[model samples]
Target: MSTGVWIDQIGIDLDAGTQQVDEAIVVMHSAFVEYGHQGQASGAMVETADSLRAELSTGTRLGLARIGGQAVAMVKYRTADGGTLYFGRLAVSPEARGRGLASALVRALRGAARDMGLGGLSCSVRAAETRNIMIYEHLGMAIIGREDRRSLTGAVIPVVLMRDV
Candidate 1:
């Protein structure tokens, strides 16, 4: 019943706990600081250990990537309608970029989704974040649609919805 993956020496724990969640939060905030600087609101910017713990209690799963025992990336995911695994808040520390951890985590989750009889993986990426869109596209996911969502700060965030082929 263990959910984990090792790729290129990075360890991904799918059933991470509070301590790991705390570490992941640090990584997330650090990674998403750009949004704050851009005067945009990101849910990842507001996540706390308690809030994420609440999410876990409600069946959302967290995946953390660690290198040398330090958290460097994380993602939150859950089963969604249409038999797809919906993942979001995928963040990698600035220092951890170019290591393929993001793609590795998605690959691992794709396996988990398949094990659960899910059809595919899906996620919403900010339309402005072309790098993330390209990364997902490289993983075989295609843009299905786009939508504008209101952030907590009332900013209209345009996001591209993607699904794996």
Candidate 2:
């Protein structure tokens, strides 16, 4: 298997199936399993492949990272009100954790935002997940504010809003 990671923006094909999409769904669900067990499952945990396909039909773009031609990490993003790229559901497979795959995906999305003339990158992280927040901080993002996001189970999750600085 190749040790190098490949990162890129994927254009969803609403009319046809794509391996990248399938791989992304697997990576997402697998990566979020911990959240599900913790009773704080994210909305992404409930998304079926078909639902994800529907979401992609709405112009949401995916950033994917692959190692050895196998998808290992993924992020979903869209342009928000302020011309900033609002990304979420960042997931890296357990086997790929600590390999810098998440960081690579973020960098790729940042480049994508720049290419689309977007102003900046933004995301919300569960406030309790300080490790994730720190990762974003290491990537040049900072906490701008906080908000409570209701999860699928109606649990109010405290999240911190972060933006590239």
Candidate 3:
């Protein structure tokens, strides 16, 4: 029951060459920066366009959300081994939080993964981001493990790995 946005018009599995590529990147950068400023993201951050393009070249899919032609949220998904869809860079605009948009995007990613015969959808959340963890947990995702991500600046990010089971 999300409002102020339309889901039917989103572009799935988009390429870097798409016209909205810049928009998608903006959504990611803004949302990630919001989380970072709130002390939720200590060291982990999305890389530059060159790395993103390389990831897209490896079959990563971007899930974009737009309302009235404005990009609001996005996530990157890639099919991992043994049919698991790994997702990252999930972000929702500051104005769009608490409206079920994140959950909707998760549902959309789950559906897309299932459509591809993927066993499940998986993602990593910074361990200190309890708000994020609870949101995903409420959506039926369980923490499966932990991972340590070393940022380019050499900061260690403790992350919780979760998967829909």
Candidate 4:
């Protein structure tokens, strides 16, 4: 199926509680397992699930991209630096890979941030994750700082980027 068709098969909804977030967490864990071991670095931490659940339960905004009545992707953010939005834990399902879902989700997030009158959005990405770094750069994010020795989940990660809305 085409990208539009695949996207159309799903509904993007603002999840109201932790249940939906938990489901998305399951998918994300599995996806990481499938894609993580082969990468240059370890993937996300399973401990992140609890924090994600908490974020969903209490956050001002929580979104899920549901495909065929199932949560296939999730994106969430928080206000940082007073008005700067920090986005993290954006994940898409393995079954839904290469369908432009991540880009679509990020676009939606930028729109939401704009409507909220936020000055900009920021995220930290691993320097080794070239594909994701490329996507963020392509979306107009610019690197602002680099951390040399910090490890996100035991793997060296680098570079914080911010983009004005």
Best by lDDT: 1
lDDT string, candidate 4, 1-165, tens digits: 011223345566543356665776666675566446665444454436677676566654556777677777776677777586777667788888887777776766666667678876777765666788778878878777767544446656555554643
For each candidate, what TM-score against the reference?
0.94, 0.87, 0.82, 0.77
Each model's total of backbone clashes: 0, 0, 0, 0
Backbone steric clashes in candidate 4, count: 0
* Model 2 residue pairs with clashes: none
Task: Look at candidate 1 and give me any clashing residue pairs.
Answer: none
Q: Kindly list the per-residue Cα lDDT of model 2 for residues 115-143, writing each as its tens digit.
A: 77888799999999999999999999999
Candidate 1 lDDT, 1-165, residue by residue in tens: 358778889998987866577787899899988898887868777778889889888988889988998899999999998789999999999999999989989998898888888998999999999999999999999999999987755678999999999
- Lowest-sum lDDT 10-residue window in model 2: 9-18
Point out where model 4 deviates above 4 Å: 1-10, 39-43, 57-61, 148-155
TM-score of 2: 0.87
lDDT of 2: 0.78
lDDT of 3 by residue, 1-165 (tens): 121234555423322244456777777777777556665553325566566667677787666776656778777778887578888888888787776768778877777677678887889898988999999999889999998987654668889999988
Candidate scoring better on TM-score of 2 and 3: 2
lDDT-superior candidate, 2 or 3: 2
Local error of candidate 2 at residue 106 (angstroms): 0.7
- Deviating ranges (above 4 Å) for candidate 1: none
Clashes of 2: 0
